[model samples]
Target: MQEYSSQAAYDRGEAVCVIGAGAAGLIAVKNLRENGFEVDCYERDTVLGGLWNPENQHSPLYPHTHLVTSRSQTEIPDFPMPDDWPDYPSAAQMLDYLKRYAAHFGLAEHIWYGSEISHIEPVEGSRFEIVVKPAAGSAARRLRYGAVIIATGHHWVPNLPSYPGQDGFRGTILHSSQLKDGSRLRGKTVLVVGGGNSGIDIACEAAVNAAECVHSVRRGYWYLPKYLGGEPADYALARLQRRPRWLRGFLTDRLLKGHRELSARMGMEAPDHKHTDEEPIRNGRYLEHVGDGSIQHRGEVTRFDGGEVAFTDGTTVRPDVVVLATGYKPKIGCCPPGLLGVDGDSPYPKLLARMFSPRVETLAVAGLVEPGVGALPIFHWQTHAIAHWLHIRKGDPERAANFRQQVVSESAQYAVDSTGVSPRHHLAVDAEEYLAGLGRIIDTLEQEPAK
Candidate 1:
């Protein structure tokens, strides 16, 4: 066994350490490099696209997974996806786009694949000591950096729920990530549990491929088609935000009215929040499948009995397979929870401006928030702010102090109303409000430095 030591770390002066080589980490490296900072990004997986790459063992992608948000909104702000691609690109296309982005920015050279950041500690004067754990037989090495950015993302750890008789159930049970091949559903009675985008998409897949498909959702959610009035749904809805406040609501209602009524007519419960509050389901075929009776919409699972499953609504299903499409839990295991301001019992980090760490000056988390839109653009602006903040803090002390307060105030505007108790909702934020706050932070950083 390799002996662990607390020896002095080799310090790389003023270089930043980015955890994970996923989309967020790639963007962080590119943006930080653009800001004249040396960046070293680490990825546990061999690939660079993070969860988007199906080859990644931790990827949450299931059969036929596609982007829910339109391409125009999903692409990185500085790097746009190919215009010829479909509005809602598939998982494969998204991985390709990320690869192209890394290549275009020459970011691959800086990334250390198969290297994971096992631990991080704050050292003298805002610097960080990181332990890089190699994927193979190589001994761990310790290094020091001026700062660290946690871009590991929240989609890796699966959130598996248990029922009363789950241990005794005889049916084949699988998480969403395990059902990568659609052929797994062919000719089998499949029960897809959860109301999130993954569940709906998988249920739709099962509807066509399986002998029977039953969808179990605990609560109601806003179901949106991929398009509205001949345009992509997210694009169409986002455009309404630019309109007059009085006219916006009316226009949004008009666009969503048909889908809302259709969901109600199909016996689905009304959503507790507005369409914009949370990520609305964006698959057009899901509702049509529900309407045609191909996908049976049911209530939450209460228990499992032998080969049968019982729901809260008194309905039971005998399925050949049970697929839990419940989403992932937000986890940052490489560092201490207290460093991320995770106080007493709560798992969610209380980040300043939803990016910067409240307890550590040189630590920040990228792409941790669910901004109800294309996440890549949000990550771009987030890393942009983070890079600029680190740059400013290094030189202009007085301006950096002022900018800190400005970030706190700006972040106050995007407080999300949490209606769901699921751990998945912990990171939810209003995209419009968050983008505005990020813009303000960027403006402060971009301002002229002291004379």
Candidate 2:
């Protein structure tokens, strides 16, 4: 790795440094600024939309990508997306929405595009010294700030899987991010791997575009249409969450009965966990493709030989191209592992309340969890709490001390404690439970300190 010399660290006293200009980072800056903090946001990409912008070289958007969650549920709380837009909007529209948000809040002036925070070090007084590396090979600059909020998000690092003889396989294999053009699948026998939203969506795409489409799944997954019960699926489900616990399950099952029966008839594995455990597959077209025999559902890929790909069930297919939609690994590369409570060799941060750093009071990570719903709203609330807490901490030491304990207790309240879950599921949170916790934390911060 090449090393660059960093200039003398310039101190921006009492200011906050926010990494990444993604939706989360933008929200963090807006909230911090609203709380009267001097916030400087850094974006590695030239644009401010983060992964939503296809122009971003590292964007994970595949062809025809759209919001898996509905517009109402996905929009930021304070700044809702256009009311005239469809229930689910396209990736381009999402980028536009984010850009609009930045413009509306005047967040662009606080953002430094083409600047990445290569590293963040804890200096004296609980402040952070951040190295800003420019994309154009300029010398790195160092700056100090009173606090830092990491909102880089976790979608950039592709979690690619290796198969036996994959190195020598003759077929072209690409991660979903690399499959930028749908024309690449045209007239080719395609295999779509993994069972996440990406995988399912790509399979449906290939079902329509490819000569033959084979979808490889490792286990059972819930296939949810974009809509259910005459409303956007996520919105409907979220509404169900407000009902009594006993009735919620019965109502949910009824709503999802058609999907479950269809998946079973198609020989799909039943998901081992509840529907809410992870973000379910949200494309309505995937199963329709399967029913029409446009998508051949197969077990996990066992090996690749010459041009033949073998599944665990011993079936083989010679695909011209393979798309691996196996999602991303949660990685915070800019900060030291210890600062985020990452155990040895683990990339995921063990955050308090899924935002605050367990080890550093002045540091927090936003939009790191998979809330199984619209993520922007969650980011809004998380950053809202963080900004409010920072404000309280600056004024009332007694209240700050009490609020820290409240956050720790709040974290435990909604934890999805279970064994044998995947690392991806580690970030999963029940959105309803988490939002309530965030609300409580905000309420605590807003309450006046005892006289």
C-alpha lDDT score of every prediction, in listed order: 0.91, 0.91
The alpha-carbon lDDT assigned to residue 252 of candidate 1 equals 92
* C-alpha TM-score for every candidate: 0.98, 0.97
Q: Which lDDT tens digits does candidate 2 get at residues 1-451?
A: 1465645689999999999999899999999999999999999999888889999999999999999999999999888888999999999999999999999889999989999888998999689998888989888888999999999998999998999999999989999999999999999999999899999989999998999999999988889899999999999988997899999999999999999999999899988877887888898998889999999999999999999999999999999999999889998889999999899887878899999998878999999999888999999999999999888888887899989999999898766653424557889987778999999999999887889
User: What is the alpha-carbon lDDT for the whole of candidate 2?
Assistant: 0.91
Q: Each candidate: RMSD to true structure? A: 1.3, 1.5
- The 10-residue segment with the lowest total lDDT in model 1: 1-10
* TM-score (C-alpha) between model 2 and the true structure: 0.97
What total of clashing residue pairs does each candidate reach?
0, 0
State in Å the error of residue 127, model 2. Answer: 0.7
* Model 2 stretches with alpha carbons more than 4 Å out: 1-7, 417-423
Among these predictions, the greatest lDDT belongs to: 1
